[model samples]
Target chain A: MNDISTWDVVRNLLDGVLWTLGLSLTAFVLGGLTGLALLFARIASTAWLRKLAKAYIEVFQGTPLLMQLFIIFFGSSLIGLELSPWLAAALGLTLFTSAYLGEIWRGCVESVPKGQWEASASLALSHFEQMRYVILPQALKIAIAPTVGFSVQVVKGTAVTSIIGFVELTKTGSMLANATYQPFLVFGLVALGYFALCYPLSVFSRRLERSAHGTRAH
Target chain B: MTYAFDFASLLEYRDILLAGTLRTLALTAIGTFFGLALGVLGAASRAWQLAPWNRVFAVYVELIRNTPFLVQLFFIFFGLPSLGVSINEWQASILAMVINLGAYSTEIIRAGIEATPRGQIEAAESLAMTRRQIFLRVVLAPALRKVWPAICSQVVIVMLGSSVCSQIAAEELTFAANFIQSRNFRAFETYFVVTGMYFLLALAIRQLMLRAGDRLIGGRRT
Candidate 1:
């Protein structure tokens, strides 16, 4: 818990970045898949299913991620299930991202002009086929930019997992800082790691936005 | 595994939970009020492209937007004291919340400002309106009306994000719940009640914001 070499701290910090990356990527992919389903359900369904999906979005989006993580991690274990910290954090982030991403994609889907739907309907395709072949393809192309943009949110969100004791980058940074008595050096590098992971996605999202502008404006 | 349900314990902590909700609501209201003012100025600066200040505002917006609210909270609560301007946890948390919300609001409102039709500005000028008159009458008012929904949602986000202040021991709802659980060891019941409270409060605030925003721009709806 005393003074430690910069190298030791850096290595430990690197492990933190790995956990952050692991948590963010796991959440992003799983969240994306789940969100796509949610978006489809929201758009292509009866009134009840749409309301259910809306409720899901509102519940997840309305609540704080930290509280959600706490509920998943500790609350479940309180009942009968013994959930791991990583599992709980991942589940929380996945649910959070799904709500946001579902809404984003739903907007994009609905943003596809009604003319497109009418045009597709004239071709005698079912609603699902219209989405699969025509609407979704265009919507997904538009969705790529915002989806990549939200990955920044996903990356930043992994920092919250530290609160749940998942020992991700932020948690590790705090521990190493506490052990080394170097909060500034430790957190500065921690911020650097997050910035490094997220800045690229930010740049990518902007590029997607530019490309989107070049083609179709959303 | 079957466990008996206990609602009485949760009900007993209603006063504590109520206090936390009030604190959180106060934080959200004060934060949104000042944050909206800061946001308006920031958006105006960007719209005006006020030299170096605009560049500085841009960096502030992007930096805050790209990072985690938790890190920002830590930086303020823990990172600021090293520079010798010590603020308490509550003040620091509120400062950070306002700063973060200000940046996001600037972006949203700037988009609104930019969307104002160019011909209206020409019309205002033809009527001999000065720059100030034109901005208030022709620019800021209508722009905010149109952008109210986006701003409203981001404000709700600020409300939700304020829960992160609990980490710094801000005595907000979540912080209060954490205290109750640690003391009472009723983690599940405590959080269940707390979560329900948060959901209800958030829904209430969101509705209020929507109604307020709609009224502010109710004329525009027609």
Candidate 2:
């Protein structure tokens, strides 16, 4: 039997960082597109679409991500569908991210001055044409800083998927800690790995926020 | 085979659920009270241009903000014991939550402090107010008022995030659900009910925090 050394534990933990990044990327991409859909639904002319989108956002935002992962992973199995941890984590995070991003983007859209809408309407632009041509471009500019800011959240959120047996950074950290019997060292390294990924994003978000504010101040 | 949903079976665990909910509320209350207090102090030090403490707190906020709360919890709950500083799940949960909330609120409150008109502070100084007096009486309340809504939402986020405390067996709502599901093997039913409870709890906490904000800092001019 081979015993795991400190170096081996660190090496395996580094591997886990890759999965964390991969899952985060997957969730962000899928969640971003879905979230854009949700934003439109939230502000749609149809009253029911807005209501339905509101409820969807509330349910996802209100519950803990851990429970959402659990239900999605376990509940699917009860219905005779074999759901992988990867798929479940992706789906759970995508849904959760969609709700938050939807709300954030909706705020950006609504914050656009009323005159823009009125002017676009007077131009006889259809609702779709107005959103596509006039409103979304402006909203997208307002949304950029926040959307990037939210990506930090999406990165940290991937850690929760470890609980559902996904072999992300946190999960591997725990495993290496158990094998090496050095919880402090192993988890410390894992925290560093996460910090390395998230800190730059945090700094970038702040810069984007400053730039956004700078433009607005002018 | 059909899996019939039996929510009635969950009624038997109502006591456990209620106890867990109360524990969660207690943890949230304790964490928020101390966290906000500490955050104001941290923000004041930064606002006052205290050199090393300001630098110290800046690093602290960045470190806490960048890391995942679960890893933070594990480090405190699991890692600390190895160094001979032992604490129970409840203590660890509270400590982690408070520390996490403190870091977040520091940044939020500091933003408010930065927004304070410089003239206001100068006027207070011209009135012969001491630094501490000016900070506490003149700055803190208004800083809190400016950021009250943001802080309230963050508090609710912390409350919702507290469900992760169950990972350390802190006996919060999530823990209750796990305990019941293990016994009855009704994982779906258990999580479903608990999720609903959490949704309701999040709503209730938001309402409660907003009311507390209004009462505490609603009316007075800065």
Candidate 3:
């Protein structure tokens, strides 16, 4: 067997990084939209809708992301839909992301003072209008930091998709480790690749959090 | 959809599932115990600014927090052998879970520690308390109480994340699901049942942690 050079491993892992980034971005955007809808259902006037949303969030949050991917990937095939690993990974991560994001944003929404809700109601605004025009606007500001913070989780989460056979960084690292017989170097680079992706978001999230608190202090 | 669900097939493998469940629980218990202990030590070191150790822990926390747990598991299980530090899959899983939870709980506990009032520490100092005495007797309990809910949530998250331990063939609950499905060719039913099992486990752990927190820290608050 020909020996794989270190440069070749690094170059190949960089290719995996793009797929990881693509998957992360796809999950985040799709998840954010779905999470927004779930957030609305969660805080809606109807008790049943709120409970339904709560149950959805609880199930997704309670179960492992790997299991979710397995169910979607394998379950879909059993039910006659042959989903590609890409589709399965995206769908699973999207659902997982939505549940957590919905819950996070829900906390932010509830943190908006009760007075804002009452004032909007006193103005004869409909529930939807109150949320769309007043409550969500305020919640959006507070939600920014946590939402950005969660994006870091989304990036880290993409690594799990590799288990479903998506050739992302982690999967690529494993393959290269096997070929090169250099597990330490391959996996170390894999961890560093993720750190490069996630650390900036973490720092940015902290900065946003601090500035948020700074404004609140005044 | 032409497929008929067959959860009954999984029942025949009940022993496998049971063993797997116990293994998963055992891993989580061990991980949580040592992880939280490590968190306490790291948090104290960082919170008190204990020189070199503080910097060491800061880098450790950042490294663990930023990377995915799967990669860490891979490094410990697959990577370490090359460095002449071999560990079995079970040991590697436990180690990964402990380290992952340790980094997170450090940050979580540190937040709690940092929130301790300046006057409280000063009062403890005036009472002629040593540094360790002040940290343990006066500062630790309330800080833990404040952060107990967050800690509980992180514990549950780590528990759920433990499902990935199956990747390295740790023979946990998810591993049982994989084995059952591969045998019966009932992937959907197997995974579905196991997911339900995980949901129940998560709920049970959350409730248990809540009660544990109340007993450990709640009474002291009054």
lDDT of 3 by residue, B162-209 (tens): 999999999999999999988999888889999999999999999999
**A-chain TM-score of every model:** 0.96, 0.96, 0.98
What DockQ do the predictions score, one after another? 0.65, 0.81, 0.91
Error of 3 at A112 (Å): 0.9
lDDT of 2: 0.90
Model 3, runs deviating above 4 Å = B220-222
Chain B TM-score for candidate 3: 0.96
Please write out the lDDT profile of model 1 over residues B24-58, one tens digit for every residue. Answer: 99888888998889888899899889988789888
- Worst lDDT run of 10 residues, candidate 1 chain B, spans B213-222
By lDDT, the better pick of 2 and 3 is 3
User: Would you estimate the TM-scores of all the predictions?
Assistant: 0.94, 0.97, 0.98
In what order do the candidates fall by DockQ, top score first? 3, 2, 1
Worst 10 residues of 1 chain A by lDDT: A177-186
Tens-digit lDDT string for candidate 2 (A1-218): 44887788878988999999999999999999999999889999899999999999999988899999999998999889998999999999999898999999999999999999999999999998999999999999889888888888998899989888999999999888777777888878888999999999988888988988888746
lDDT of 3: 0.94
**Best by DockQ, which number?**
3
Model 3 lDDT tens row, A1-218 = 95789999999999999999999999999999999999999998899999999999999999999999999999888768999999999999999999999999999999999999999999999999999999999999999999999999999999999999999999999999999999999999999999999999999999999999999846
lDDT of 2 by residue, B142-204 (tens): 888888888988888888888889888899888999999998888999999999998998899
Order by TM-score, highest first: 3, 2, 1
TM-score of chain B of each: 0.94, 0.94, 0.96
- Give the docking tier of candidate 2: high
